[model samples]
Target: MPDDEPALAAQRQHWERTFAARAGMFGSDASAPARAAALAFREAGLRTVLELGGGQGRDSVFLAASGFEVHALDYAQAGVAAIQRAAEAAGVARRLTAAQHDVREPLPAADGAFDACYAHMLFCMALTTRELLALSREVLRVLRPGGLCVYTVRNTSDPDFGRGVHRGEALYENQGFIVHFFDRAKVERLAAGYELLGVEEFEEGALPRRLFRVTLRMPLR
Candidate 1:
């Protein structure tokens, strides 16, 4: 593990405990962003989706049932198992795959293996700026040319942006979880190798956490 990003390995353990404690922590419904992404994916003729941080499989089951081939990855073992359970219960097991993976490493898929990549608030996790950049490059690597990457992150406008214990590099810890806040410049910096398609701000949860939904695309040569 990299010394600078020490919080990540601990975070995996935190998530493991959290997921084990609460079976359906995020509830059964798919997030609004996932619903929106599904429509866009369908319209774009993208059939395969790689979902990162697929907590509890809310979006994984939804996407699979909606006809997109879904492969959901989460660092926590319990979370990954919950995804598989949810997929099986939804009868979408045939269409969905769940795996435990740390996104800090290279993505598990082959080059050009997916048609689209989606992650709802995954970018806002305990990852640092450098880790985010590397993860973005990995996303680009696994996507087919012209494939789309849709991800959301809490922005600087979020209510908890600077609250709680400060981790290095735009990250803050609340309770036991850490979040990395983003701004327009950071988004643009990560968009280096991809076409920046859109950046839309939205709100979620009772705290009304402010977030940005970023869409990027690999260019066709």
Candidate 2:
């Protein structure tokens, strides 16, 4: 099968290069958003989770350690390797699976294969608005009924919004990375198939990025 379309292939190559330059792209800690989702996962009795753009497997390892089966997907092979090593070291290898995947394509898992889905800044990773909408549908497709999808994205209120060169729509090419900042309207529009649970605003990093933690649940049939 084809790896990815031209645009997505370019993005994948960029992330691969980034990961190769450093031992690990993101740090070893699970993202705050992922940690926050654990409580909701517990409340819902979720067992299996599909994590998109799981850079270096930090959140996957954490989720697995927390007793949930995690399938962590990233575009970079190096990141997948890191996740595999981390899971083994954490003694959660049986509970964690890592693979290289591009979310721009349809998710490879069976329908309703996962009890929950998580993404940390995956929606903001240079994907176009249309691609994000398609991905939301794919996420919903792979999730079991009533499964929750939790994701974070830089919001339009972020301090860095519009600070970089425009890359079309709400996207910007900043420094060496590309970002597609979301607004409340865009979030709602993209998440139409699912029930919106809540949206929380939080800040992170030195840029003090304004981000939204969006929670959506597939309606029970």
Q: Give me the candidate number with maximum lDDT.
A: 1
In candidate 2, stretches whose alpha carbon ends up further than 4 angstroms from where it belongs are 1-9
TM-score, cand. 1: 0.97
Candidate 1's residue-wise lDDT over 106-213, tens digit each?
Answer: 999999999999999999999988888999999999999989999999999999999988887788889989999999999999998999999999999999999999
- Among the numbered candidates, top TM-score falls to 1
lDDT per residue (tens digit) for residues 78-164 in model 2: 889888999999999999998888887899899999999999899998888788989999999999999999999999999888877
TM-score of each model, in listed order: 0.97, 0.94
Once all C-alphas are superposed, what RMSD does model 1 give against the true structure? 1.8
lDDT (Cα, 0-100) at 134 in candidate 1:
97
RMSD of each: 1.8, 3.4
